[model samples]
Target: MNASDSPRPSALDWLVEAARVRDAEGLHRTLAPRRADDGVLNLASNDYLGLSTDPRVIAGAIEAVQTWGAGATASRLVTGTTALHAALERELAEFLGTASALVFSSGYLANVGVITALMGRGDLIVSDGGAHASLIDGCRLSRARVVVVDRGDHEAVRTALRERTEDRAMVVTDSVYSIDGAVAPVAELYAAAREHGALIVVDEAHALGVRGRGGRGVVDELGLSGAVDLIVTAVLSKSFGSQGGLVAGPTTLRDHLVDRARSFIFDTGLAPAAVGAARAALGVLRAEPDLCDRVRENARRLATACGAETPSAAVVSLIIGEPAAALEVARRCLADGVAVGCFRPPSVPPGTSRIRLTVRADLGAKELDRVAAVVTRARTAVAATDAVRR
Candidate 1:
């Protein structure tokens, strides 16, 4: 038979087959609509401070909509920049004790914009091997010579920076890893960066609004705030319980990103409502620093109940091994009156698939008890199911 005589599969057929493989592994994902008044205990969301549904936050969003008319209209450099945006930037910088801050449409964009804007073909980026997807993509897009060190391996990062042929180097890490919830050795990493004369960028997406003084984040907690050379990126959606992101650093860094970062330069600005809500959320944070302690306490309770390590923040992981098993446990928890996160590979390494639980500051004893019970029950059920299959 001639090679040209063979038929090729349709694109839809290829997709269907790929989906079948995922389904077989219980890795298929679907969107489920969640209601505001569902009354279900939420241990799945990233609202560490439980400020999302606060009356004040809602009021702030409403006020912003009324005053600014919803959209930002254009890019920041265009007509998109607003007084609210400026205010949020100023306040966030002051809160984190950074010299300046620049807002972006999302955290991913902030990482991409900051990294790409600062580095290029001749520059080097030594990223943590387990960095968020956004940081990885930024490193790839920056056209920089990229090196990945083991997560929190300060010595490896130092060596990479020192050995790099590039004149400029940047070391990137998460203040707290998104998956395992492990806190990064930020202080040591910063020390390495300083020794090697490399810039350090810490993504505080999972750290902000959970750790530090009044949720200022790990940077401030380490007393490294106002370190002009250290750059920090954070999301407003998680702990702030709003939308958008920010890159906080020195004035020159912010100016460089504004001028050269395509993600910031070309994208439409963040909506007015999100800006107002985040700003108001900061007010809530300042008024109630105890909420940080509350969330950490909740996280510890959940972690202790699950036999996991003492949590560094509000996130805890329950490793279930298989994607199907993890999914089953998450569904079981939801059925048992609680919602939890299910992570699968490449979201997590194979054989380490698990459900990530974010213990909100508002979760009470009743909620915590239910979560703990469901998890234990789910594990037993999963073991039984596996035994039957075997």
Candidate 2:
């Protein structure tokens, strides 16, 4: 057949087939943006301290916009280094008791940049099986010999580090596992890394606002902020109620990242408004240290309601087994005025679909009681339906 005689191959046919497959698997996703002034009790968000809407944070953002305009005009190495950015970095370093900090556009870039900058083809990277996607991507992009140990396996980490053929090695993990809310054995991991003379990177994205005194984070809680081989990374969007990511560690590390981290070197600096709001949130966290306690208390309460283990951070996850069932539970909760998070494959492993419930400091006890009731009813109903099907 001639080229023009045969049917034309549609360039987008694969996407349509992929969508059909996803739909059949009950994995099709759609955006559902919350309306302003919506009365839904949001248990799905990462704003643990509820500072996203705080007047001070809003004001800080506005002031920054008025002063520095809407966006950062350039990358950090160029003209984007504003005084606000410097102040935020200094304040973050002080708050976390780190020698210095380098801010990135987002936590994902921070992970990618840090890994690829410090590690290369000749180096070794020991990662946790449960590390965040950003960290996983960083490991892949670093072109290093990567070995993933089981989550929180210090001995395995040590073994990997010791067995490394490269002269340099790094161990990376999340301080708190995001999905299950399991806290990593960071202290033990750090000890193991030290014994093997390897550097350790702890992604404190989930723990920064809920763990340690005044929300200093797990590293600070464990008194490892001063450890020469330790690096702590956190996102500003969660407890900080802003947007951006930061790497806090020795000044030498910050200097190295600034020079070698391509993500930092190429990406525009975080917006002035985000930087300002993050600074304000830090102030709020320092002033109201009990916000941390309040969030964890709420998490524990939610955990009890869902029959999940108490979380070390602000996340309370209920494993619902199947994606459709988990989605049903989330929908029921939302219909009852409580919006919880639903996680399926790719976000979590297959067959481990779950409902992720996050707590906020500003949530009242009465509100929490209502949330607990709604979640319990939804879960029970889903379980009953599943049993009947079985």
Best by TM-score: 2
Tens-digit lDDT string for candidate 2 (61-177): 999999999999999999999999999999999989999999999999999999999999999999998899999999999999999998888899988988878999999999999
Which lDDT tens digits does candidate 1 get at residues 213-246? 8888999899999885799999999988999999
Clash pairs, model 2 backbone: none
Local lDDT at 200 for model 1: 92
Evaluated at residue 299, the lDDT of candidate 1 is: 92
Model 1 residue 315 CA deviation in Å:
0.3
Query: What lDDT, from 0 to 1, does candidate 1 have?
Result: 0.92
| lDDT value, candidate 2, whole model | 0.92
lDDT of each: 0.92, 0.92
Task: Tell me, by lDDT, which candidate is best.
Answer: 2
